[model samples]
Target: MAPSLVAVDQLTVDVITDNVSDTYASKPPFAVSELANIMQAGAQEISGTTLLVANLGYGLRLTTRQGSKEHVLLFDTGTEGAAFLRNCRNLALDLGTVEEVAITHGHWDHMGALEAAVGAIVARRGQGNVTVNVNPGMFNERGVLLQNGTIFPAARVPTPAQLEAWGARVSNDGDARLLLDGHFYYSGEIPRVTSFETGREDHLCRRDNSEEWRPDPYLMDERMLVVNVRDLGLIVFSACSHAGIVNVCTEVRRLFPDIPIHAVMAACISAA
Candidate 1:
């Protein structure tokens, strides 16, 4: 059965990490720019240090409010710990308020800073206060084959044990479920049905160090996040869309056939 998603009155998405910092880009009335957020956070001078770091990764701090209640959750952790933490500090984000951390996939760029992020949350919220949502398929060794026939291995995300030791209650389940009291829906695994929306052709992965690199083009482990906003419909957040954005939206529509999709946030293309 589809989960009964709760409607939130408002949602705020802070781009904690991304590949670009578009301070001058024209945005909707509901959106804010990097410079505005930084200055609001008390930046006197707009230097390289005061600005948020742009990297080859993605992360978002999602906050939702319904009536008198508000919930905070993390969608991803970006590529590195220092940059992720630095952005958090620069934006004056309170990691302590994060009730849950849902990783969109096992890619290093998304889960690279798992340890540091969880540690920061645990330091403020205390042990076992936050839950880290993940799935089993995200723990494999991944890489990409180069033109010269050599495989460039990507850094593996922190193990489940590492997350537990860092004071996180890891919900390592593979099935779709509601998160943070139904304010968010963490998908199980995206089904690829689009003909032209094929996945990455160079992706490779293996179970362990001894296993040979096998084709992982589909990235079957990738998942997406969804939120139902009051009067606005659905807001979908697909971190990298290795499963394809069309397929992601298809899944969303299938799950909530009556709800109109308000918007979709995805790192579908890399400009860097």
Candidate 2:
């Protein structure tokens, strides 16, 4: 049967179990069976709200209620191993059916399994079948050095050529063209309407031994996935929110002022 697109959620986070001395040394501890039970229980709690849970821990996969024949927008692929693949299999999800993989930044953890993930998708769909939309040169364009002198550049920033070679397309506008109808929309570059998010400093990227920090209004970190549900306002799924959550909410309000913010899930909190 042709797979119909459906919104579903599943648990993607995994409990680290292998090679940890602490976990391995415990009495009857690190039991895969026990851990699986606990994970299953936790998964049940959030299952109702999840559209499609991809294992961001390694790679990504998508599954829906109807069956495992749904498509997914993978954010990042985990490092090599059967861990990610096995997780998908356990969830009855197929990595070969990913519709898009959006790499939030150039961080190793985020894009580690990018090639593998793409290969899986290609194995299902013929060569040059899928499009991977990425922000063009976003990593090379900007960054910031924290007050503690720690530098944070744009992570996982892949060039257009690099993405194309992997059977994907790239865009810097942060707008991803939709392949399936009724998919969630992305709230592109957010507008800082409130004073709560202003005066953020940009990290310096040194090319020729010269260092400089400046005010970056663009704050390239401002991006989110917005889902406009019937009565639920806007549901936003965020990666590392370099731009404060408030800033992201404000931008959502600007574009969709009438919509209420139903929920927000993010990986990092902005120090700004």
Best by lDDT: 1
- Model 2's TM-score against the true structure: 0.62
Residue-level error in angstroms, candidate 1, position 250: 0.5
Error of 2 at 176 (Å): 6.7
Question: For residues 1-272, what per-residue lDDT tens digits would candidate 1 score against the true structure?
Answer: 24479999999999998988887678888888898898999889989999999898899999999998899999999989999999998899999999999998889999987788998999999999999999999999999999899999999888889999899999999999998778998998888888887777789999999999999998888889999999999999987888888888899999999999999998663111
Which pairs, if any, clash in model 1? Answer: none
Instruction: List the lowest-lDDT window of 10 residues for candidate 1.
Output: 263-272
Best by TM-score: 1
> TM-scores for all candidates?
0.96, 0.62
In order, candidate lDDTs are 0.89, 0.50
User: Which tens-of-lDDT digit does each residue in 190-225 have in candidate 2?
Assistant: 555556655345444322225553445445634566
